[model samples]
Target: MTFFLPFSTVARLRFGSASRIHIFALYRWNY
Candidate 1:
């Protein structure tokens, strides 16, 4: 399980950044 920790963290960071960019695009579209 120890080896899986870093993979999960990296996936979470990537997903977080993707969602942030998506939200930013939507906000720009609305305004």
Candidate 2:
């Protein structure tokens, strides 16, 4: 379980940044 902790944190950060980037692109596309 301890091993899963770091992996999950990294995954969450990556997904968070990816989603933000994706949202930025979509926002520009909409404009």
Full-model lDDT for every candidate: 0.99, 1.00
lDDT of 2: 1.00
lDDT of 1 by residue, 1-31 (tens): 9989999999999999999999999999999
lDDT at position 15, candidate 1: 100
Clashing pairs in 2: none
Minimal lDDT window, size 10, model 2: 1-10
Candidate 2 residue lDDT tens string, 1-31 = 9999999999999999999999999999999
Q: Local error of candidate 2 at 24, Å?
A: 0.2
**Structural RMSD, model 2:** 0.5
